[model samples]
Target: MTRRDMILAAFVATLWGVNFVVIDWGMSGIPPLLFVAIRFVLVAALVVVVPRPAASWRTIVGVGLFMSLGQFGLLYTSMALGLQPGLAALLLQAQAVFTVVIAAGVLRERPTTAQLVGVVIATAGLGIVAAGRGGDAPVLAVCLALAAALSWAVGNVISRRAGTVSGRGPLGALSLTVWSALVVPVPALALAVVVDGPEAIATGLAAFGWRPLLSTLYTAVLCTVVGYAIFNGLLARNRSAAVVPWVLLAPVVAMISAALLLGQIPTPAEAIGGVILVVGVLVTSVRRRGRSEFSLRVSRSASRSRVSAPVAETARAAD
Candidate 1:
């Protein structure tokens, strides 16, 4: 990757990391679900100008359902219920583990030994967090953040499957992000109505002021539109191995920012578990890259040396 892309990746990670603080500040006096509706309303409006992705509507809507609606709805609600910004950022990355497990079951993509080990390690970290949450981080709030991670993982699979519906990995990822957003607003608003009621909704709308407006603009424009655009572009230009690790910086940024700005610091258990969780994600991602590289080498050898199909299959099995 070029220096420019590296800078851009860090920039995106910073924005995403700081987003928890932004959300906490912005949602004051507003219903969490309603905030989701309002934010997605701006995001969905981009469909008027941006072209639709190459994926089918079902794929798009499925991505929207889990990625946008389910993930953010639970996330915002969890924060409102008092999960700290840094911890929420850390816990949400459980999606990395969830994504691997779900893909193994639903897509029949068996994980490598390294990945399985990583999953166990990450789960151990989660157990630690659960046991040590204490009073500051409510159990229900932690569960909701975890549920958000699970939802995000499901969405990740759906988006990945869409890329392969025609047997490809590369995709019109930014377009899909924009188009799928069309599925978020109405459902979020309806959920807000159900959860918060008409009076709260009315009050939330009335409470919409500078902070919320700034939050909407930053999230919709910088985080969703520009951030995804740069990220997808980087993936298109670079190896997934090179691109993915930069994401590790996000939780670090979140934790540091929360500590400095919000006066929120992780408890010892939370810190230890967060570190383990990050290590697990790093191991999984690195092994995945190794697998891809090995596959590439095998494919090249088979093409050059006329490797027999059975020999190739046996080698793959051994791998």
Candidate 2:
């Protein structure tokens, strides 16, 4: 990656990492679903004025459904139900394993041994987090977060299936954002009405102080819009193998942000497991890149030799 890309990736990571703090803050005054609804509304408004890519209504609509509606709906619900912010950040990275599974099973792609190992390690990390959290905390919320991870995995596949765009990454993102912002609010608003009640929601709105409001803005503009834009741009520049490792950095960023912002100290188990998880992801990504490079070299060499032999045969026949 270029220095610029590296910088952009870091910015994306920081934005995503800090989003846990934002979510926690915003959930204070606004109902989770309603908060999500507000975020999406702003995203829709911002992207509509931008140069978005042209795509079939089907692809655009499908991606927006999985990414915008499904992912955030489950995630916001999870947070509201008492999933800790730092840990929530870490668990969501399980999307990698979900993506790999979908790629192999649905897309008929082969999995590398390292990828297989990553799946195991990530599963282990998830197990640790699940094991660590015990209480009157709603188990449903934790399950919802897992659902969100699965939703995100499906979204990744949709983007892949959507294929390449001709300088339409930003435009495509905008279209997806608008579609997502529009389609998702219905369910979110509905859920918020049922749970928070009209009066409660009104009270929350009346009570909406600057902190929650600003935090909501940050979640919408920085984390969703800017962060996703950078991530997709990186994917456009490099293969998924190169681009996906940055996700591993998210949990670390989350842990740090949580420490600084919420003063939530990590347990020894979390700290140790986090290191292992990161190392495992790094190992898998590096080994996969090496194998890909080797395969490309072999394919190129074989093509060259095949072309050279046909020319040599033609020259000998002429002679």
Candidate 3:
């Protein structure tokens, strides 16, 4: 990747990492479901200005269902139910594991040995977090977060499959993100009516303030629109392996931002578990032999060939 691309990747990661804090603040006054609906509505409106990609309606809706609605719905509810922002950020990375497993089953993409081992380690970290759960982090919230991750993983597969079927690279990530987002507002509003009640929705909307509005705009414009645009552009130009690893920095950024902004310091046990979880992710996702390693191997092989040439010629002359 070029230095510019690397900077863009880092910027996206930062935006995404700080997103949890924004969500927490945004949902503070508004009902979670209602807030989500409004956010997606804005996203759909702003981004749908772009011409639609050649993707099918099914593909757009499927990505929207799981990625936008399911993931955000569960995640928002999880936070409202008492999941801390920092921990929520960390736990959401479980999507990586879920994606690998789902791809193995649904897409027939087998997990590498490194990925399997990373899952084991990550599972161990989750076990630690589960054992240590107590006052602040409720079991239900954790479960909901895990469900969100699962939803996200399912969306990943849907998007990948849709891309395959369309014979295009997932109809451009930005297009999928925007078009799929069109699927969110109706169901989310309906769900808000059912769960939060029509009165609560009306009240929340009436009482919406600048903080939540600004939060919504940041998430919709910066996090969703700009972030995904850069990410998709990178994916188009580069390998998935290269682009995907940069996302690992997101949780770190989230944790720090949560600590400074929200005063959400993880418990000692949670911290230890989080470190283990991150390590497991790195182990699972990072390539064993990257470009530098390949270059080194090539150089070594050339050197060996050069050294042996003279010896081989001497032996032939002697014979």
Candidate 4:
């Protein structure tokens, strides 16, 4: 990557990392599902100018269901249920491990030894996090975050299949992001109505101010759009091995941003668990020697197509 691209990658990572704090602030007065609906509605509007990809609606909607609806819905709810923003950011990285395990079962892809080890280490870290609940984190909140990660992993598999079925290596990132996002608002709004009730939703919307509005726009534009655009550009110009590792910086950024911006300090147990989880992810995603360039090419392609929050960790190379 060029110096300019390197800066762009880091900038995007910062945007994504700070996104957790933004979401927490944004959803403070708003219902979680309603806030998500509004966020995606804005995302859809912003990306309307981009030409739609040639992929089928089924493909688009499938990605939306898992990636946008399932992932964000659960994530926002988890944070609302008292998961700290910094810890939430770290826990979401478990998506990489979840993706590998899911692919092993559903796609019949065999896990590498490194991936298996990473999974075990990550699981132990998660167990520690779970044990710290009620004091460090809420048990329900942690469980919901794990479910969000699993939902993101499911989206990754659906996206990979869509790419294969379309005979395209992967759909264009912008197109996939926009079209899939269109599938989110309706169901999200419906659920919001059911869960938050019409009066509460109306009251929240009426009370919405600049803080939440800016937060929504920042997430929709910077974190989702600009972040993916820069990331896809990096992949287009360089090898995945060169570009993807930069994403490891996101958790660090998230933790620091949370501490500074939200005054969120992780407990000692949560901190130790977070380090183990990040190390496990690094182990799982590290490029092995003797792997073919063709495999790298596939990883680059997958990186471009997969849609998640910039902070949403992917397990493409592991697959």
Please name the candidate that would achieve the greatest TM-score relative to the true structure.
2
Q: What ranking of all candidate models by TM-score puts the best one first?
A: 2, 1, 3, 4
Question: lDDT of candidate 3 vs native?
Answer: 0.73
User: Relative to the unseen true structure, what is the C-alpha lDDT of residue 234 in candidate 2, on a scale of 0 to 100?
Assistant: 62
True-vs-predicted CA distance for residue 123, candidate 3, Å: 3.8
Q: Compose the digit string of candidate 2's lDDT tens values, residues 95-178.
A: 877777776677555556675776577567656755665543477877888898888788766665554661245656545555
What is the model-wide C-alpha lDDT for candidate 2?
0.69
The per-prediction tally of clashing pairs is 0, 2, 0, 0
How far is 17's C-alpha from truth in model 1 (Å)?
2.0
- The count of residue-pair clashes in candidate 2 stands at 2
lDDT per residue, candidate 3, 170-199, as tens digits?
336677678778899999999989998889
What residue pairs clash in candidate 1, if any at all?
none
For model 4, the stretches where C-alpha displacement exceeds 4 angstroms are 1-14, 133-136, 164-171, 228-251, 292-319
lDDT of each: 0.75, 0.69, 0.73, 0.71
TM-score of every model versus the real structure: 0.80, 0.82, 0.79, 0.77
What CA root-mean-square deviation does each model show from the true structure? 5.2, 6.5, 8.7, 7.7
Residue 89 of model 2 has an lDDT of 78
